[model samples]
Target chain A: MTLPILQLRAVGKSYGTVRVLKGVDLDVKRGEIVSLIGPSGSGKTTLLRCINFLEAYDEGEVWIKGQLLGYHSKGRTPQDRDSEAVIAEVRRPVSMVFQQFNLWPHMTVLGNVAAPLVLAKKINKTEAHRLAGLALERVGLAAKVDAYPAQLSGGQQQRVGIARALAIEPEVMLLDEPTSALDPELVEEVLSVIRELAHEGMTMVMVTHEMSFAAKISDHVVFMEAGRIVEAGPPARLFGKSATPRIQQFLKPWLDRSLSI
Target chain B: MNVSPEHIELLWRYINAMLVTLGVSLLAAFIGMAIGFLLNVLRICYPRQLSIPYRLLVWLIRGTPYFSQLMIVYFGLPVIGLTLSATQATVASLALYSSVYFAEIFRSGWNSIAPGHLEAAQAFGINRWQSLRHIEMPQALIFALPLLGNQTVLVIKESAVASVITLPELTMTTGEIVSATYDYVGPYALLILCYWLLAQTIALAVRGCATLLTSPQRTL
Candidate 1:
């Protein structure tokens, strides 16, 4: 049996006493596009963050290519947490594209994309720049390489964020509302890039509110609510005939809107 | 306007004192900026170890007046057998005083950086030091430029306070020239001109640096 590229076995997280993720079990096989659809505050973003150990889940295991991350055991104490170096090593195969397009304003497009490779992977400047150039080209941003992020439009800046994530050559890509921050006119450009990545068989777990886009591109659709997975299935099954009442109710507005459109 | 030749010659003789003033200011600014940079990094990255001590140092230095701090370093420390020369005491006190402000400048700069930038770095597997070097420091320094320029001028002006310790800096030399020549007006006027020119030069240099750091067309 082929192992999943990313796995979350009963993952759970909380802030103070408010539990955010309650036993989230998920697996993304290679060449899969899993779309996480949910209402606001449904822990979709938190789940994506936990996959790369960016948020540090307090319960269960996150396995990237079969290696556990962030903690050695289920223990949540400070002592039980792994060293930063170890955590980085385990999560190196995963990259994330954020909602805010957190491009460093001081850096040019090439510098922003090349920085991760140079700093994290120990790649030399020339080689990192070459890779960054290719990534930018893939995102249709080759001309903007010399431009500062502030000089670009919001759509263009988000493309730079995607290029930065792509330069690392990740095994799995996690996207947390990648197009939510863009203007309505600018959203299609970013969505097209994501759709292209999906067609190329990039393993992606994306949290999105764009129901139509998610339904069209996702191999698997997982609906979440109140920090739990209410339903999970193929796009056809989840969108055409969801078994759970909560997911049906949650997706009602989106489904109706898409139908009306 | 019967300006005496002796008075002109004495004023010219104070050039060495002006050099001494500039030298001490340069040294103090360099050392103080270095300390402030290290302290800010320590507080941000290793807060568990250095946060309390960092807060205490900022409070102690910023709470006291610069002159009093200078006196404490120059005179009070002698009680504990830590005696410094007049120049040494002046530089130390000035460095400590400026470091407090520099530290706050760096802290504010670092805080101004968007949280998303650091999050993106962490997601890419960049280590903490690498994140600071590649992402945080450049942007923070850029954000802090205007304030840093103001602090540089402040340091240069405060160097004049070294006159209290009998150090032959610019202000002390001007005082000496006036006392000997009995021409207070000429010597004081010349001193003001010299200081104004020095401040303007520093201001011009800082503007150049700010342009270099922040010019968007410069690229990476």
Candidate 2:
């Protein structure tokens, strides 16, 4: 078995009295696509944010490429801090695609893709643009290299968002409902690109509402409710035979629709 | 009373001098703004560093009168043996004054961006500097343009105060011409006209730039 590229152990996050994530553990192996399916506000997005240290966790550890992230201890007290030093360390191998397609509106497509290569990776501008052009071409946005975010449709923008993620050559990519903001017709275009990335062996942990897509593409489907995963396994056994009533109830309508279609 | 032909010639000369003064002020403003922008970025990224000393400098320059600041640079520097030309003193004072206000304007503009934007950038492996250069600074500049325009116009007017140090700028030339003729009204009136025209031109340019900045698909 290939070693996992990412792991979250006993992860918990709370904002004041509300516990958003509670002792959740998850892992993503290299070249595997894992789908995180849950109700709204169920900590799916929070977990992704925590992996990249975008949201600091209250407890637990995240390991990326074998490095224990943000686990600092001088005295017995242990400090929970998201310093730039720690964030930069964790962010080196991970990239995220946001739900809103947060492309820098001021930058051209090439600029958006080339910036990280030049600034973070310390590559020259000429080589950065060259690589960025290649990444854009992979996502079929080569023609729109000079275009801005406002010029593109919802699907195209999401593809650009994906291209931006790919330009960095990340080991693990976290996508937080990447297609949620798209129109129904535009949804498949974004999903197909994601599907292509999965086929290319990109390790992805996706937060998705589309159960059918999750079932079809996911190597491991995790069913989350409230703030914890209740069922997780291969799509066939888990979706065909949900042991818990909660899992059954959640999957019933989704299964019926898939069967009808 | 007939406006003297020599006064008309002097008025034209005053215009030329004011143009030079404006150029100096523009350079100073640009330099000050560049430094102030660096400070603003540091303060935003690390709020703890924006200490009382930093705030005091901003407040001191912004609080004190611009003319007094010019006086300090012109006369006080001479007392310390770092004597600058009148034009240099004027540029230094106005630039320092405008930069403090520019820094505050930038700070406010940076605060206005949605946090989601930064999060998205972080997730994309575009580190801190990349995010600011490509994402944050451009957006903040767009929001700060109108205020920057107002500051630019103020810098131009403040160049008149340099005339006190005998800088041969518009106001100084007007004073010299009026004192010689004993008819201060004509030359000073034209000075006021010159300032009004300059301010209006800068204002129009600022509005035009702001329009293009906010327009869709133009930046790319």
TM-score of chain A of 1: 0.98
User: How high is the DockQ of candidate 2?
Assistant: 0.35
What tens-digit string does per-residue lDDT give for candidate 1 at A156-242? 999999999899999888998999999999999999999999888899999999888999999999998888998898999988888
The residue-by-residue lDDT of candidate 2 on A108-227, one tens digit each, is: 888788877877778898899898999999889999988888889999999988998899899888899998998899999999999999999898999999888988999999888777
lDDT of 1 by residue, B1-220 (tens): 6789975776566677778887888788878888898899889888899899999999989898888999999999999999999999988988889997999999999999999888888888888887888788988998888788788778988988889899998899988877877989988887887778777877898889888886755443
lDDT of each structure? Answer: 0.89, 0.82
Candidate 1 lDDT (Cα, 0 to 1): 0.89
- Model 2, TM vs. native: 0.81
How far does residue A1 in candidate 2 sit from its true spot (Å)?
A: 3.2
Docking class of 1: medium
DockQ leader: 1
Question: What are the chain A TM-scores for all the models, listed individually?
Answer: 0.98, 0.95
RMSD of each: 2.6, 4.4
Relative to the true structure, candidate 1 reaches a TM of 0.91
